[model samples]
Target: MKKFAMVSLAGVVTLGMVAGPATSLASTHEDPSTTDYSDVDTGHEEFNEGFNIYLALTNGDVILRQGDQRSEYVSDVQRLLDTRGFSTNVDGIFGPNTADSVRSYQDTYGLTVDGVVGPNTYQSLSDRHPYPNELFRYGDRGEYVMEIQRFLTEERGMEMAVDGIYGIETERNIRVYQEYSGLQVDGVVGPKTWDSIFTYVR
Candidate 1:
């Protein structure tokens, strides 16, 4: 529960909001104004060229800029907030709450305190563990978990019915797995469980 001070960008005075303690911040994106694509006259294709798709963050953590307004990126930011126990609306508005959460994230990760997602901030996000989507593999047994089941059946020789239902048998199997791996034998497919499951898959 560290406190963060929001400073205006009068000068480039970023205090490494995420990774504090004087860790140097890196700027991976070009100096172009990273803002909403709607304001520019450039066509979609041109904007796509400079859209920085490779800079997308999969985790609920990111370096958000002060004035960005992309729907997809806003979704990413919202996801980050949700992952970190914040229940803010994911409406891509870049409002005050998002700003405060970004400040908290910056302080947590020790990034520049600009509250603007930049390259150095993006790098910090990439290194985070327990990303939001990782939980999808457990519940619902959707496409992702189904894929995991397939890998388990083919590789681990565990005779699991691929019915996409995480019931008692699945939990039992998971407990057996955790016990075998010397993990907390709670029968849950947590991050450590997933990592151990990978060993069996290959």
Candidate 2:
């Protein structure tokens, strides 16, 4: 295993291990200091490899192609494709179906109809359905709320309906997740909460 260090704004450093060298570490976030890198490993080589891909995805530096290994980042790209009306399975593996979907998306968007998801294709999809940046609290409603609800349910195993409405139940679940993540136990979803959530999704 090879050790890597990620430092936070508070001057706290956490270490993780990967079975091989990381592919990329580029980022587009305005303030990298807000991101938390605590769950980057599980002491297993296979799991660490997936986590390395996840980190690159969150950093906006991943270049996925056909025949790539399984990783959550591939699943994320599949989800984005499906959201744009190109149906594809959300399986973690980047197989032929995913490549076909990427080609279709690229063709429709007037991009080079290559199956690979390099920087330009990824940026176009991101621009179309950009991640939510506004602060969220009780009574908010829309796709952003649904995004957080889905993240909480899928990633954190929180039992809640992804109805795109921030109600008491949603706030309660957010508070629970905040407390568990060692963040401020406030119900509002702000920069810190978004950073933590995107650590898994981006």
Off by over 4 Å in 2: 1-54, 58-62, 126-136, 139-144, 151-159, 175-186, 189-202
User: What TM-score do all the candidates reach, one by one?
Assistant: 0.36, 0.50
lDDT of 1 by residue, 85-193 (tens): 6556788877777777777777877777776766565445323232122442223333334444543453344556665445444545555545545788665565766
Clashes of each: 21, 0
lDDT of 2 by residue, 1-202 (tens): 0112333336643222233222222232222223343542212343235446555654558889998764667886787678668888888789999999999999998999989888678756544223344677766565566777875665445667897667656766676667656788777888777776545332
Best by lDDT: 2
- Residue 22's lDDT within candidate 2 is 23
* Alpha carbon lDDT at 194, candidate 2: 76
Error of 1 at 125 (Å): 3.4
lDDT at residue 97 of model 2 (Cα atoms): 94
Estimate the TM-score for candidate 1. 0.36
